[model samples]
Target chain A: MIFTRSTLMVLLLTVTFGVSFALLSPIFTDAQLEQKTFVTHSGRVIETSGEVLDPVYTVSTVDFDPDEFLRNFEYGRISISDNGQTIRDYTIIAEDDKVQEISPGVFFNVWTFNGTVPGPTIRATEGDLVRIHFINNGSKSHTMHFHGIHPAEMDGVFEIVGGNGGQFTYEFEAGPVGVHPYHCHVMPLEEHIVHGLYGVFIVDPKEGRPPADELVMVLNGFDTDFDTENNFYAANTIPFYYQHHPIQINTDQLIRIYVVNMVEFDPINNFHLHGNLYQYYPTGTDLVPSFYTDMITLSQTERGIMEFQYDYPGKYLFHAHKVEFSEKGWVGLFLVKDNSTSEAYYGN
Target chain B: METSEKTSRIKVVTSGIIPFVFVVLMVAYIFGPGADLLDLGVPLPELTIEKIAFEKSEIHVTVRNTGPLPVQVVMADVNDRIHPAAIEPDKFLNRYETALVRIPFEWNEAEPYTIGLTTDDGTRFERNIDAAAPALQMNFEFVVFFAIIGTYVGIIPVMIGLLWLPFIKKISKSKYHFFLALTVGLLLFLGIDSIEEAFDVSLENLGGSFNDVLLIATTVVLSFLGLYYVSEKLTGRADSLRISKPVVIGLMIAIGIGLHNFGEGLAIGAAVGLGSIAFSTFLIVGFALHNTTEGLAIAAPMSRGKLMIGKLITMGIIAGAPAIFGAWVGGFAFSPFSSVVFLSIGAGAIFQVIVIILKWIREEGDKNLSSAAVAAGFATGMFVMYATSILI
Candidate 1:
């Protein structure tokens, strides 16, 4: 009764057209949108593109306070506005510390560098000479084996360890701008890495990529039970740290994330960006990005730089795509907002 | 003149007999020996001998749900005799959902067997199936064929909603509000259900610690506040009490329901892939009913304005296409943790909608507000949803 004569005619035409289209869809359907394609070799493409609708630029202060470890944690682009800087100097001390809890009552005995799980990020421009003074204040011998281009003599190995309070000054050129991770190169590498003697090294591109809000994330895990498997995983040595004190990024600017996976026992780790895809520079080594993807897998010691600008303001989730890791602790949020309205809620 | 009169009389007799025969046939088909043909509001199950292989000692029987309702298949009988080999314990068959029912009956190539399927609904369908009538084969072509079919069935609710839009103008404003209240009531049920499901996951896996509890709590609060901020921004108002724009609220409601349906689709797709065909079938029936009610929620608010047909179709797609997408992925790779996250997000979004609806109701002013009617509508919605859920 609701179908008038013209409406009925239109309905009949639609049905005929709809059936015809369904039958012919395969011939016309593009393999990209109309068909499902899973890339096994390359990373998954969750979302294709992100565009910044409006550009608003203003200086805003965001508090990074959570715990002492998070408060002291350093991120962002190196202040190399003066390219005249020729030398980068850094020092790291290896020590053993007992933690009351890794994830709320889960205790662990950690081997740390510079009194933290992931030592301070050493940022330098390409072709700059990097000098590092390494000291082992712990009872056990420790060495810093960096996953980057350097001389073997500067490599922290057991042979060069002076045991308790021994110091070694190593100098090398930081070339091939990329995110690199440095960890203990002792014999039992898995045990040392799981105990938390790892940190990220960011070597900025020579011309320096356009400055945006930069961040350094080191993926590591803890094996509290002495087993080869990790029970607790964290982005920066603290479980659920980002959930408490989320990283803030003002909208209308590109976000650069340097992610390194150093969990020894786990074979593979991945980072999945929720609601965004980034231009991925694998190990930051290439001038041209290899791909633009929302998720990428990292083997042990693998690192990369991701750049993207959010068009909308929201709590964007950044975490290991591995569900187990995310559920346990390897999850964080990027609270993006406008510069005019957003203020530091968790006052540092 | 005499020849013309005779011919006209013959034509009249011919027409009368044909009409009488057609009426008798339809009545018999609907109510008598041919009842299975119409099926009539009951689930109809059909069985076909799919494939027979030597030395396998089992014959694959394809149990198909051909009716509009899901049926719990209690037993299958061979030649009217109870056979343990023919019945699968705790098996269900969903509407249009098929399963390979294996019976440990040695097949004789020359023999024809009458397979009877008895559903829990007390309806039975019998088929005299030949063991060798072009046996059902599995191949890539068949896989794609079934996938297309599955996808078609998955988006049925969305299609229904789109088709139902033109008549929405006929509904009065008062009726629309009643339906809107009803929609809120159903969403209330859904939001609570989803949250309960998420909390169950947390309790079982997260050990109910402070962080786990806090995670769920914060997700809800953050989702509400985040949407609230967006709404405020859109309306250009700093006041918390300001009513969210109707279109924005409508979209939010649709998005929330879409998320929930996506999760439901994942469950169905995963189940189908895992050979839980009956469970998938039941879910389809359950979710189809739920989605019908959900379509009302999306369309009810827009009754005041003359929306473009294209815009209405887009709204329907946004609200309903997720189920198909979810099913597509879930069929390939099903992850429980991911499902939990989806369900949690859905819960939070729907919770926000519930709050917004309450504010919308309050802003309607005293004269238009009927507390009893709203309450009744809410209870009716809950009842309808609860009733539909029990069928699955």
Candidate 2:
């Protein structure tokens, strides 16, 4: 009896509910979401944090000091008496908490690009030319390089940051689509570049793509004066700073990534994309027609672009190739959802 | 009172003769070099006498998320070729998904021609027309209107087969495992092909989900067999004996039925082809109804007097008739692959049913003759459908 009554009521409700849902659901997002970030305040806050999963890759926190980073980048100077700080201070957390120990004192003093590691991820399409305009307010000279796509003139070989700083533009028609890294190509390659010159770049193919999301990580390491063994950083020296953040994307979208490395001694880096394999190869250099892969590795100045659709939604990781790279400095995580995963039983 | 006896005797005479008439029709349908009794009319030549401009790129396009979540409109275009879109059911089409993606356009002058639209599913909708001229803002919407419809239509045939359960109650209570298994195979293949046809999707697309559909489809077949087997075992022996003359007569009926049903999808194809939009809709509904009752033509006689050969022959006619119809219709319908699906499925199911009947005959030690008859039954069923595919 109860079932019968409920059945009729439920039947009526289903139609009403279905019609309401259709009427309410929007088919497309507004254009404003795609626009670049705008500064609301005069001040800046950088994020700092990191983690370590393997010896080859290390994730440490960037102190996220906007002054040090802002000084090296030429966005704009914030006034002391202005509206407020330009950047917001934030924390970068790791999936596996406390991967590595930082030098000096407390285990945490997380570093972030503007307080976030890998700086705010630089996003661009396959054909779009990307410009990395940077300023070096820090005492040392710095450089930048991208991993996903290759640039003709500026491969980040020279010091990208010194005096008033400089800009590097990355241009290419397209490549195998996937997530890739960018970093300073400067020598001693591990030390200076690793200090904080890394990020990700994504290149999405024009057709038959998949659903994907991105997470960015840039490994940072410093030869602190207190380190007893200069060689110890190689075996297990902790990172001084690091950055981590996520890149949300459209549903059924092919996941594309651009990563860079800034550390010196660690000239080589790898990007492991969890879950779905990267569907496209950047640099127009792929061995197979349907080359599907889980991770992409590159050296300083090299960027690999990855494209893949997320058939299933879930939270996954995108991190450095070198195990030690993640141990102290390089790591990031992203969440992918399309409402289907809203229910519990629908996942692996 | 005298008329009643005569009427009963005449009914007997006619019932006995009906099979003969069926046989003659079958021979004519197959050997008669292409002819259809329901040759209603050449759909295009008869109807659609207006000019409407359809090909102007005034083709305005709008992507509506009539679905729950917003969808990024990928690619939209008008294709010339008419290819049947297959939906791999396992394909993860999200909910409250984007449906009815419209490509709006206006023609400077209206004219008559088949208008077609291609969607993500690969299914195309085509219509024939004679139009006034091209006009401004002519709406040529390429709405993927069938995704939801496909999902729902997927339930119909299964519901029909299920509705038949109470009536098809089995005869004996004794265990008939192999017979049951054979029935399971026949239905399993039939539903798979039907669903496969329905979705325009392939089993191969289910990255990992293929196994799941396989298991479910098998279960449905097995469940039906199990219930029937249990029921038959409890009741009594099924009429599995052969009446030779009747067997031949049943074979004839099988052929005739095959002839008539062959054009089942023709109306839909022709309606769509000639741009009879309203009729095209009517045709799909009408044919779907026509197929549901088709199972009974053979099933009814088999129930009245169970002849293994008769059942096999009936299955052939029931299954093969549609192919011939489909083949004929496919010509004007502009979809050639449609017959392949109908043909393959018709063949698979009939082949399965024949196997079941042959096994029973074999166990009884019926001579090689019965085995030969079973083979003939299977072949005739498949051949009639195969032949019908082109008869159109």
Candidate 3:
């Protein structure tokens, strides 16, 4: 009887300690997400001399990579499907391509998705059905695997691969809205990824995001020497393309950038915008902005949407915070011209 | 007769109606104006430890808010010999979402540290972490390879020897008793060793925190009690068919030793993952020698003439296979919580086996040896195990 009582006492003490510890512990809730306001500006006035002042650009139909047309592609306002079902159908081809001058005079061979490093950004509203038809035109077998909730049978893998010159269809419901990445999950995955068989998949919120001049930027890199290491990195596979041809935006307009880190070899990359603070939406899944910061860090395949309005007209530079990555090729400039003047000049 | 009937009716009505009335009143008090009177409007925040990692030099915790409301994290503090300053991650974990809190403290891997977190909702969470091998430090390929090799290395010789156990049955009964006693001594040493290792997690500061000490103690006591209860419930009933007590005891020892060996495998695997090749090799050698004796221990009780070869082989597998599995797991992720839990349970199980063997010896009435000889044999067993352990 004494032993049983003692055992009960011990058990009681243990239970009390556990419950009290849970209630009184401090480490569980030490951090908080606080809101902070950054500096803001009005609009800007710019005087131009026969220069293009629009962030918009026409898709080059005859380019080596046709998916370059998707850069400024508009994914309009989000809404429920009229038929109460949102079905997004897509087809991608995996093939080898020897491209010329990723950067000036830097020729390289790459395995491409839709003839581009980062296939194409597939966009859809929440609750939409995403159907991807994948074709493997490459000599070696390849498969498409997406990073999101999906059925096992629909997960594009080697066993279910449409082998070389074969076709396979992957279908799933667009979910609990977030930014997701799709890539070749074939063995020798790193080789295929480094060579370029990847893309971004964006699921917009059901309620839709606030209006903005949206743009898609998929950060990627190239292994010039086939050494399993990247020698050059780019925002859109076109190395230094943004620097040579800067993206133009109007001052005082909300600029939303959908950025993705598709760099294979490196573990992390970051976006640091000069002289601007933006509301960061982690994975585009959150209903409200999670963070407001000028610099956003992400690991490989971590993608998100960033929103900010350029109040003054000046060159806003954006690049990987890793100086080496920026120095190689992952840098761009946003030319924010005076909205009133550009509009009048263009007679809009 | 009427008065008695009336008394019985009153008893039944009172017995059922009083509790019903009490429950109704209590419910009304709780849900009605009692809520206003008590001012219990605020819901308590429930914080759960979703994940933890000692990555780089700092501790990273993924905390989840399982409650309906969001929680504000106030401070993250670590308590040890060198108590670190409280770090305010200053983050809010939303309902059904996770927030990663980075605690700025250099972990002393050898010492157990209690991490405490406080929230705005007046709830605190405390977790004990002893050792953490970051994922970056782990080499999965080498871990799996060494784990496989270590498993076979530790028990293959014993397994092969089990194939030749038929000849051993020809030996004398006294020899069997000596071997059994020696095996008990080895296991006793192992149980003690395991307990000591588990005790290390508390940094040997038994007085400072009662909880850690209580955890290890309770695990030992409960594990023994659980096994005893299970065995008794299964076999002690008079209606049940009789099973050989020695066979049951042998299987129990093998299982207990298997758990113990799994812990050793984890250590070896972790060593490999940490890139300490020499240490892993030494551990493999020590564990292999240790396991050979364990094989002997398993076969010690099997003096029953009808022991099948297949059963012996199965026993060998049971005693040995878990080490490889442990090594594989350790290579990928190493958590001190699992280590302590496994070791404590193993110690408990081994301790129970010791009790059983001693009970059998007492019942059999050892005419072959005096008390001094028994003591000497037990001492020799402990000494041999200790000496072999030092090699690792």
Which of the numbered candidates is closest to the native, going by highest DockQ?
Answer: 3
Candidate 2, A32-61: lDDT as tens digits: 222222111122221112111111112223
Which candidate, 1 or 2, would have the higher lDDT against the true structure? 1
lDDT of 3 by residue, B269-374 (tens): 6676545667778888877876777777777776543686676777788778878777876566554445666667778878877776666655554543445545
Question: After superposing candidate 2, which stretches have Cα over 4 Å from the reference?
Answer: A1-183, A186-348, B1-200, B203-213, B216-220, B223-352, B359-377, B380-384, B387-392
State model 2's lDDT. 0.37
Minimal lDDT window, size 10, model 3 chain A: A50-59
User: How far in Å is the alpha carbon of A239 misplaced in model 2?
Assistant: 34
What DockQ does every candidate get? 0.00, 0.01, 0.03
Q: Candidate 1: which pairs clash? A: none
TM-score of each: 0.37, 0.27, 0.41
User: What local lDDT does model 2 show for residue A131?
Assistant: 43
Residue B191 of model 1 has an lDDT of 83
List candidate 1 segments past 4 Å from native.
A1-85, A340-348, B1-392
Taking all chains together, the TM-score of candidate 3 against the true structure is 0.41
Q: lDDT tens digits, residues B1-392, model 1?
A: 99999999999999989989999898877888866776556333342222222224444445545455555554444554323332222245444334444444445654666665445432445556433222323456644644553444435665575455556667655555676688788888888777776666444322222244565566566556555555545545423544336666677777777777776766666556544567777877777866777777777665555565665566676777777766765565443334556666677778777777767766763544567767777888788888877876
Reference interface contacts recovered per candidate? 0.00, 0.01, 0.04
Task: Please provide the root mean square deviation of candidate 2 (C-alpha atoms, Å).
Answer: 26.6
TM-score-superior candidate, 2 or 3: 3
Expressed between 0 and 1, the share of native interface contacts present in candidate 2 is 0.01
